[model samples]
Target: MAQLEQFTTPLDAVVSRMRALGAALPERDGVAVFNRVYLAVTEEVGRQLDAGRFPDPGAAITLDVRFAERYLSAVDAAAGGSRPPACWRPLFQFRRHPGVRPLQFALAGINAHIGHDLALAVVDACRSLGCEPAELEDEFDRVGDLLTTLEERIREDLMPGPDLLQIADPITHLLGAWSLERARDATWAAARALWALRRLPELAEEFTERLDAAVGLAGRMMLTPLPG
Candidate 1:
């Protein structure tokens, strides 16, 4: 417990610094932050790879899907007739950090496994709505599929041989492949949903339900918090 606490202070400080840095970050800087976060998360996941101590990536993806739904409800309430905010551009901007390319190898692999699981959750969520979830489902589903593709495309590089991560992440290669506009639309939809939920409690019930589910999943993932 004492040792765990030691890591907390440093990580919190790093995250605080990252946020402070974020204030001055240009569009590219946001991508840098994402890359850094991805690296850190990937490293942590890699450590867990040996023992599989981490929660399933698919589960994490599912949690995010629920977050999106909650955000949608909230956004709808917040804006009313006003146009929804643009969130996808910022997110895409965040996804392609330059200096942080070192972590791409790990992200591609871990994200691949989780991406499919997350996509399934999205499809299920859409089905529950009684109408086709064209925008939301398509947008998020693309990310999962892309991650899966990234996994396969980069598998060899990530494995033994030479390291390709230092040069560029597979995602970076997709640049010029996609117009920033596509991501911008999705980002706006997601942000609007989040902003809306914060302002409207009644409509934000989904957020609470999903949060509860996340906690429950955590508990279920491990019978207890202690190490095996």
Candidate 2:
């Protein structure tokens, strides 16, 4: 019982912050669009935690909270006029562009989060919990499954109606080129590589920077504006 209470504070704090962001941002703002999607996922995570669904509740809480803080930190950086991480730059830059669809915003955010942040979050959780990445595999898989399900719903809900989805629609091809499953797989690999390289600070830093830039590039491509 005490352990559950211990896990609740951090999760509740993050959930509260997400809810505040959802209420504060404009409905159609790209960041807001992503924020709504993330808020839903975060709330669901809390529910799962409360229901005692995770095998290691402490590990789950650490990973989930650490994962969310990275995104929120980027938001704070941008809001404070500091440069956000490379992986997050495109979404912040294109957040209000009329040409970018809501679906694009949502996917771009997911791409950045999964591709860059998830890897680091794994490391963060491992360090905080004094465990190896392998120990967190179940937590990672469960979270990935949750995100995968949400990705499908995001596509279904934000995708244009049949009348609007013409063969010539660039978004159709643009979105098709990226796969959340592939991204998750790559992130897992990256996390393991990072854990291996942790002893080599310079190499780890370089690898992290390169990963951030690569993910940011994909995010930039995902946000490619289409003709309205």
Against the reference, the lDDT scores of all candidates come to 0.36, 0.93
Give the alpha carbon lDDT tens digit for every residue of 59-106 in model 1: 333334443343233235433654322221222322433433322323
Instruction: Evaluate candidate 2 by giving its C-alpha RMSD to the native, one decimal.
Output: 3.7
**lDDT against true structure, model 2:** 0.93
Query: In model 1, what is the error at residue 179, expressed in angstroms?
Result: 27
Q: What is candidate 2's lDDT per residue for 1-228, written digit by digit as tens?
A: 455323346989898888889899999999999999998888888899889999899899899999999999999999999999999999999999999999999999999999999999999999999999999999999999999999999888888867365456778889998998999999999999999999999999999999999999999999999987
Candidate 2 off by > 4 Å = 1-7, 163-168
Winning candidate number (lDDT): 2
Q: Model 1 off-target regions past 4 Å?
A: 1-132, 160-228
